[model samples]
Target: MNRVEEPLLSVSERRIATRLCVDAPLGAGQTVGLAPQQAHYLRTVLRLSTGADLALFNGRDGEWRARIDALGKGWASLAVIDQRRAQQPEPDVWLVFAPIKRARLDFLVEKACELGAARLLPVFTQNTDVSRVNCERLRANCREAAEQCERLSVPEVAEPTGLRDLLADWPADRHLLVAAESGHAPPVAEALARAREQAGGRAGVPASAAPWAVLVGPEGGFTEAELDALSKLPFVTAAGLGPRVLRADTAGIALLACWQAWLGDGDARPPFRG
Candidate 1:
């Protein structure tokens, strides 16, 4: 387990090659260290050198451009030069879904991150097909998606919780958008449009709506009793993704996309987009 202890960057100037989302605080003159895996990626994989520059963001201070002060086998440090973008408000939408297979779960988490979901929650329903959820994998997928999508913050991954318990302890003000298949639910856009109108188009952190969450059941779908229970919640609004049946991953992404377009940050443009 020997670690490299050499400097990765030379004194010469270079443009940023990539952006990394780290857990360290970002600031000017701050020397942030990279995790072992990240160091390995830059050293052995990317083969970046001592003079290279890269962007760093911690979902806190803001995005910074940093120079590679040093890098080794399992260690790397960057000297934060300046902030490229100030932290801005983002949508507070949460994606609460049942765990599907590994591949689909990976896709779901990635798409959820790209779609601006503030949180990633996995819930176990009575008809759920999977018992165990790999939260670490979901986190990895989320991290990569955030970096690639130019998002300032990575969605928080929550531990797996039972549907009943989750519902019982749910936040009072947060509205839950349940994706219904065979119910009297309105279309996803139609439902969110109504809620947006009711909220009077505030256009704040999450556009003009209150806190919201999109829930998609397992592939087998929710049991009749579970659906009935969710429908009864005062904060729950069952929304349909049309007549065709969608896979759990598809439904979650589709519903969240519609929600963002309607009530979330639909009007806000990406900071990086020119």
Candidate 2:
């Protein structure tokens, strides 16, 4: 009989093997206790037993190789053996989108974390269907996405705010990219390039060095008053996604991908090791 060979795991799959993010401090030879929920997730969901080796990361400290020292019904502990990778600096990008349905909102948050968004803001627009958003659920989605994507840090999820309030308190230095549904606006790439050029002229730093934030409107798109207000803002750049109008969630993902490809680390090499 011929011997069979096992297929090798992909880079992303191998990186996510028994990997978790804990909210405790990590150091060499440090013993960290897992929260009750985390313990349940490991023992019940993952079926991990004591003495199992797992990788851990806390946003601040880098990734570490740890072993499960103790496992109980509601308690677990891990011993850090060594650091695997150092924490890398994330892109200074924020995603602001109108709150839509529950399922799509969760999807948006997860994808935002995977795509290297530093912050997530929920903006309530005039046409927004959802009146309230559960910020905790979004944060949990971000954590799960970060762990699976091998990201060093999870994006910060902010509470939902009205569109008017968000713009009223907009920062002067940060550039805002508005996804325009109208065909009159320029393409997203052109707008980004123009914003970069203007930023470079004002500041000595390169275009990629400037902070960026993307705003995607609700399904119905921004109202006339909202568009007029955004147009008046000096930091806002209106850009069209394409010929056809996109759904709220799709538009958010497309805008983030385009910005990352042009200015963020989309073209950069992957830092994750198999």
Candidate 3:
């Protein structure tokens, strides 16, 4: 029987750390009060008493270590001890997906955050089954996933928009990677490689320089007219996942993983400085 070696933990994972994404400002020696729901989570659900240490991040500021100072019936207070990590740059990858059933949509949002997507945009396609989406719930899912994954920032979850509207106002500089369910489309890796070459020299460039996005359609996939419209876009690249068709949730996760591996922060070594 061979023992499987576990990968080394990053610097942020060594301690008995619990993280919370809060709305309040954070600074050293600053006292911040938690919302009622957040306080309930820490005090009742987590059984964390006063004087316990936890980490906090507001999506804008970096991670901070805070000590619980007071635990009242419906609220809790914490004093910021120090900053853990300065705000780090995340990949400039946006995940745009057509909303599906409730459970699958929740899964998609969670996985997107763990994969370091900077934004999650829901687009309504012609074949999209789920017309309505709860943006607030999706935002909560993103925050929870970020907390569990030790991510310093939470992906911004946007309101659902029509595919036509999104394309009409799409930024010219941002590259859109469309997940093609058809067989004739190029592989995801190859498509990303081509986009990278067109953008600059190598892959994994700084987020500011090369902003990229992945668009996954609904379970029934895109209609011919919709596909044609997407294909005609100059900034869009149609890429296939594999030979077999994948569920909407699976395709979204697979596409994101491919993009991160090819041009995002999936590398083991530090990205080239020069």
Candidate 4:
């Protein structure tokens, strides 16, 4: 690294405050265009002008330094500079939950992204009260959260689907963790710890860090039949979050945090930008 021609990034230079997730391709000697909303944010909210420096990242390309070439009321163009950080591996954790209220749902999406969930899935369970989920809004929240959290990629927000349909076509390779409220089951940490040991021992299941999905039911819990059906699925594993009741959003967030702490990449430290 010391022998490279390009100057190495300093700790202060690595810590840029303004990070934007753009759809345009990023590379040296390329022009990246910002969307109307992003332009508005820079122009009005941040009061940034031409030649101001910021960081840009797309889910595909790695993070890059950019200098503003043009700035206006609703449009901005930037000249992409050298790369700051290369794309790195992230956990394949997905949050599948019943849609809650607007505010709570937004918060859930943000926390899930910061907590290293690779995807967001809103499912319609038997007891779900919400009929329709606004996916576009969720995407906006996810993108903002990813940018703020210094993540190289934004978590994918899947279209809302029925629980029945989801499980019917669920991939055999991925495992699903269902939060059980009523029945007796092993604690989440215990279950995950045991599974981790088994996986390390070369059991039938894949390694502990494999892709996983966590399912959180709606305010009104799943019906008896729903539980039975889910339990019968080979890929589904029920884990208890303790005796206390938890809101739909809370349960989802807690489960993901627990998984990351137990089986996911909890050992990885956040990148130092300062």
For all candidates in order, the CA lDDT equals 0.85, 0.83, 0.84, 0.85
**Sorted by TM-score, highest first, which candidate order results?**
4, 1, 3, 2
Worst 10 residues of 4 by lDDT: 200-209
Mark the 10 consecutive residues where model 1 has the least summed lDDT.
1-10
lDDT of predicted model 3: 0.84
State the lDDT of candidate 3 residue by residue for 109-139, as single tens digits.
Answer: 9999989899999999999988799999999
lDDT per residue, candidate 4, 222-268, as tens digits?
A: 99999999989998888998878999888988998987877677776
Candidate 3 residue spans exceeding 4 A from truth: 1-14, 199-203, 268-274
- The alpha-carbon lDDT assigned to residue 34 of candidate 4 equals 91
Candidate 1 C-alpha lDDT tens digits along 1-274:
1112333243222234588999988888999999999889988988997867788888887788887889988999898887878887787889999999998999999999999999999999998979999899899899989988888899999999999999999998999999999979998878877887788854443452478899999999999999889989999999888878999999999988888887878777765432
How does model 1 fare in lDDT? 0.85
Winning candidate number (TM-score): 4
Model 3 residue 125 lDDT score:
94
Per-candidate TM vs. native?
Answer: 0.91, 0.89, 0.90, 0.92
TM-score winner between candidates 1 and 3: 1
Q: Model 3 compared with the native: what TM-score?
A: 0.90
